[model samples]
Every structure is written in C-alpha cells, then in structure tokens.
Target chain A: MTQSVAMTINGRRREDHVEPRLLLVHYLREVAGLTGTHIACDTSQCGACTVLIDGEAVKSCSVFTVQANGRQVTTIEGLAEDGVLHPVQQAFWNEHGLQCGFCTPGFIMAAAYLLKQNPSPTDEEIERGLEGNLCRCTGYENIRKAVRSASQAMNGTAAEPSAQLVGSAAAPVED
Target chain B: MITAPFEYARPGSVDETQSLLNKYGSDAKVIAGGQSLIPLMRLRLSQPTALIDIQGIPGLNEVRRDNGSVEIGALVRHVDIQRNAMLRESLPILVEMSNDVGDNQVRNLGTIGGVIAHGDAAGDYNAAALMLDAEIITNKRRHQARDFYRDIFTTALEHDEVVTAVRFPVSTGRFAYTKFRRRLYDWAIAGVAVQETGSSWRVGYVNLATTPRRGSAVEAALAGGASAADAAAQSGSDIDPTSDVRATAEYKRHLTQVLTVRTLQKATMAA
Candidate 1:
C-alpha cells in the first residue's frame, strides 16, 4: 500500500504515491531522481543524506517520506542558482573541501545550514556544527576551512561566533 | 535503510491519535520527532506496524507559561527549545543541554517529549527533567518524572497513550548539564545535571543506571556543608555505574564524581 504525499522539493511541487515506510533519502534518490543527496551510512550517523527541510538541515535517511509530505525540501542538487554555485558550494570548491567527493554534498549542505545559523562561526564552532557529517577521507582541515570561507563569503565579515554558542567545542570529536 | 512496512497516519488532534493507537494496539507507535525511533527502525531493531505521527497536532509546539510552571509541548523540537527565547531566559540549562544533543540536524527534528518517551539513559534531557522535578503530562494523566522511567529505553507510557507536554516548575535558578562523551555528537558516557530549587539542590545522573537516578545522598551531603569534593564523593550512594563500551564501572564512578564536582561548582557559582 502507498500513501499519496505532495511536497515542494527545491521549489518545485512534487507529488508521489510512496510506501509508508520509504525514507526521505530514498524518495529523493529513487522517486525524485535527485541522487545528489547521498546515503553513505544509511543510518543517521554519517549525515551523508543531509538536506534542508523547511530551511533546516535534517538527515533525510531518518525521516520517512510521509513525514515530509507538506514540507519544503532543498537537497544538494537544489542549492545552486542558474549557472552559479551557492556560496557554500563555491567555498567548498575554492578551498578543496573534499578528496573523494562522496561526502562533499553532505558537507556543503551542512555548511550551508551552519552558515545560515551562525554566519560568523569560529573554527571550533564550525567543527562542532558539522560533527554529524563525517569525511572518511580525513580531510577535515579543508572542510573546516571551507566552512570558514563560506561564512566570509555569505556574511562578508567573519566576526567571532557568539560567546554563548562557544560550548564543548573543545570537547572530543571521536567516533 | 527503510523502516519495516507500516501504516502511517498524521493525525491532526490527540484524540484522533489515541483512536489510531487503539486500532493498532501494541503494533502502533507514536512518532513525535522520530529521531531515536527511526534510527532504530532502520536497523530493524524496532519494527512497528503502524506509525502515529503527531506532528500535525497543532498547539503542541510552543513553550508557554501556565500557572507556576512552564509547559513545553510534546511536539516541541530540540532546535526550537535551544533557540527559544523563553526557555533561554527561564531555563538556560535546557538551552545548553539542547545545544549538545546529537547534532544540529538531530536537534532540528528531535523533540523533548520523544526523548522522554524513548528514555535512552544516555540522552541529556531525562536527567535534566528529573533533576528539575518536572512533570510528564500525557493524554491520560500526569506522571511524575521520578516514576516515569522504568529502565533503559523504557518508560511508563502505554501503547495507547501519548505524551502531551512536560511541565517544569518555573525556574531561573542556577543549573548546569555536563555530558562526558568521546565525540561531539555521541551520547553521554556519564553526565550530571544539577539544579537549585529554592535553597535545596537536586542532582541527577545520566547513564549511571538503567534509569535516570537522582542523588539524594549527594544533595544531603551538600546541605550538610560538605565540600564539593566530599559531596561528589557520595555519588555512588544513589546510583550504580556499570562497565559499558563507553567506560568501565570504576572509571565511570570516578568520572561521575569528578563531573559532579564540576557540575556542582558550575551550578552554585553561577548565582
């Protein structure tokens, strides 16, 4: 049995009859044909399927398609403007954020959300903000740099992150 | 990565949700945020045949002041709590704790009622709620935080019941939540939540036992003018620490004591 769900994906109204158990990540890839949202861990750990639902970053794999029925979803494929890249994507490209590129889309989406939330995050804040998304390539230095660069591009001034948000950033990032 | 095939219903009201739960019985599960349940479902650890999504239930997403307590709706997301000006002003510890939850993405979807319902020992909110003497209000009746937790991953909630809101006594008191974890987004290995209600102190431990345990012995020690170190030395009085993948029993005991000192110092010194 399938449930009819209609949601706006990347500003385009999409309607589909999806199984009740289908994950949002699978719906985006299989049904919507937007494979830019990768699913590396499939579990919620890797954040490889991260996307913006209603302008907030969420792990697509953890949300059922029916749950997002009336929401707006913005995947990595929906980030770029006509013939131009989003600031985070451009910063990732400029700073060489990924080596294998498998985790880049997730990183970009996570970074996009982070910049939107804290447009002037410090290095430690960036690290804490993107901890959900992992890079098996161990290219975190560049990823952090890419986020730092993204903040500069979007806000035009990279002031220090607010003192309140500066928490447990000194804490470990181990698995 | 998909949950087991299930029937889905997005009920617009709690009454409709209760009816769906009655129709599905034990096979039905209430999904508020689905952060914890969906992950388990993807791993096939939990395979509920029916999902009762309570997101469409309106008026359950706000943190409002009612009488002498603050009422946080069951559908209030962690992200909302973290960024909520009301909670940040009245219950700053919750904002701090909410910020340290799984991650930004997890916070964006996870809800306080869901966390309380899931009852993961490592989750941050259970200890906070217990330490604050919060009340768990369900569709059926009000349950005290002390009796709501049965065990790890277990709560007093019935299959046909759903949490409607959590009532925390209005407090701008000094409090601190310190979670010890190996990773930024990882669950707490052992954490402490200390909140001051009037002249007394309530201390709660996270992941120290099968349930969130409050340390009355530590509180008594504090009341008796025991030093921070001495009060924290009584941490083992109320809770039992176990050897887990995070740390050994002895290490968790020691860490709990040390963390208790830090948590206490943070709580008292704040005001």
Candidate 2:
C-alpha cells in the first residue's frame, strides 16, 4: 500500500515511502516538514492547502502523494530566498494584509501564481483570480491591496531596498 | 480524512492500462486528473481497491484538429482547453464552458476525460458536450455523447474500457452556456446550454434531471419560429427533475425556464 515517491520540493529533491492514500498536503506538511502549507479545511473547498505543482497552483489536499511522483512542488516555505521575502510576502507584510496570519501563506502562494499568469490585472481580474483562496479574518480589501502591490513590485516599478545601520543613536524608536 | 488503502499503478501506455483494468475489473478506478476522484475518495464515497493513474500515459494529452472535427486527447486539462488557440478559433463554446468549471486551481488539474467519465449531473461540460453532439472515443469503441450517461454519476463506460479522446465537430454557428449557482465555485443548481446544430438549435439542460436533459420542447418551439421567451418557457416540458437538497423541483424547473431564455437570447445575439 506504500509507494516510493521522488519529487523536488521547494527546490530540493526528496524521496519518501508514502502510503498510496497519503495526500499531498500531509506529505508536504508531515514528511517534508513544510508546515507553512496549512490544512484548514482538509477538504478542497478551502484553498489553504494550495501549492505549486510543476509551477501551477493546485489543491494539495485533493492530490495524492503518489500522483505527484517525479514532479516539482513548491510550498509556501519556498517563497523566501536568502533571508529575504518574496515580493508577494513583502507586500503582505508592508500592507498589513493579514489579520490572523493563518491564511497568509496560502494567499501569498495563490497570489504568486495569479501574478505569474496576469502581470497587470484589473480589479475585477484580481478578484476573480484570488476568489479561490478565502480569508476569513481579513475582509479581502487588504489582501487585494497586497496583491496589487505585489504585482507592482514584481513589475520592477517599486523602489529598491535601502540598507540602514542597526542600533544607531539616531535610530527611530520601536512601536 | 484519508482515502482508503489502495494499490496504485501508473501505466505508461494505453494497452498496459487496459490490462490493469481487465485484471482489477470493477474494483479498480482509473484516475486522470484526480480532481473529482480524490475528493470522493477523501470523503469515503468511493474506496476502490486499486487506483490506475492514467496521467502518466504518453500521447493522451494532445489536442489536434483533423478533417472537420477537433480531436482532444483524454488528458486535456480544463485550463489547456480554455487557453488552446486552435480550440478558441474553431470552437469557443468549449472554452467558454471550460472557463466556468471549478476555480483556477481545479481547472489546472481537472481534465476533460476525468470530468466526462465521472459524469456528474450538475457538471458544466456534460450539457455542453451533449449540445455539441460530441463523440467519446474509448479504447474499446466510440460512444456518442447522448448515449454516454445512464444515470447520476454513471456512464456507459465498461470496466476495462479507457476513454482515449473526444471528437467534436467544428461548430461555426452561435452557442452560449449559462450556469446558475449560489457561489462562484459551487456546482450548478441548474444550467442551460444553447448550440446551433445546422439549421436548428440544440438546447440542453444540466442538473435539472438525473441525466443530462435535452430541452426538446424548447428546441422545437424555436424551430417553429417561436420567440426566445416562448421557447424558453417550454423548457420544463421535456425533462424530469427531482427535488434535491440543492433546490426544489419547482425551483429547478423555474430556473431552467429563466436560464433557458437568457441563454437563448445570448446565443441569438451571437448568431
């Protein structure tokens, strides 16, 4: 009942002997220890378990681990690189897009996939694109703002990051 | 919840797949996109002893146009169908209908063959396929779309038969599909599809019955020169729908008429 599956996760190759019944969501969270991909509804109704399978977003909860054998999977944990956040993640942080933070990873992953498909989407297009990923805490206005900001950031219009020395005497006080 | 334990095999060829099917018989289920099957399995509605994954089979995912028809391979995903340039130019109704399927995530993995074989009554592609007079090509033989469905979630597919592709004749006339649902991603409570077949219109209703229902009375009224409103009013005359949790039989019937009128008007304007 167990099958050997070989897949590249978040850019690294992984091999696991998983049950044929093991869902991709569980596989990503448990075996790979990529707990960033949350499983809120276990069911496919919620996009909390969304991930990029071969660069296309799909519901990992609905996909079996065996079905993803020899494929590439990118989880939410894979979004940041070299201690820097992905543009989508940075947008979410800068715009105060998330209230609960439970749905942020899934939303960021979904937004990443959406912006890839549409670089400069209209307001209606952004609504239709992220309709699959639900945010119960935030009424989606801030999430929509984050997605638009991320789109602008990814298009190279945003200002570059500035490096500032820490612990300086003139440093601003923390909130 | 996890799926029931099952043996898994990914056959690389159609013949190999058929042999596995013949060996496992009805205890085995063929999984293409696994969009519908995986959900049912997780819900325990289906617990097959063996799952034959056909997604690895080669050459079953291509969309080619031949003669006067467009031949779509069984593994053609909904997103591919919607984005296919050839299909968009030759038959855009299929693309339009594909756009209304499950959300972007679902469409990325859900395939035409998977949807057709699952044959849910409320499925968006069922009535569209029926209206287009599509032909389902299986490894064993070909099946007309009209003869494909037997009942709710049932199809004419044999245990060992594998659906290879579907052939749809190129349609040059107008077509429109309207699906009524409570939410954006929910399945249709009732749907109306209008496709011009030669000199007459073919109207098909979804979720109005246990099987895909042809609005024969509506089509006939239209052929007799009745207005769209009158023809749409006749939509409830030809089909038998049940009162399910989704809607009352009366409500479904009412939706059928109203959606039929809206769909007919859209199709007519396109024509």
Best by DockQ: 2
Sorted into a CAPRI-style docking class, model 1 comes out as medium
Compared with the true structure, the alpha-carbon lDDT of candidate 1 equals: 0.87
Measured against the true chain A, the candidates' chain A TM-scores are 0.89, 0.89
Error of 2 at A134 (Å): 1.4
- State the TM-score for model 2: 0.95
Per-residue lDDT over A72-97 for candidate 2, one digit per residue giving the tens place of the 0 to 100 score: 99998887776567778778776778
Between which residue pairs do clashes occur in model 1?
none
DockQ per candidate: 0.69, 0.78
State the lDDT at B267 in candidate 1. 80
Error of 2 at A56 (Å): 0.4
Give TM per candidate: 0.94, 0.95
**So what's the TM-score on candidate 1?**
0.94
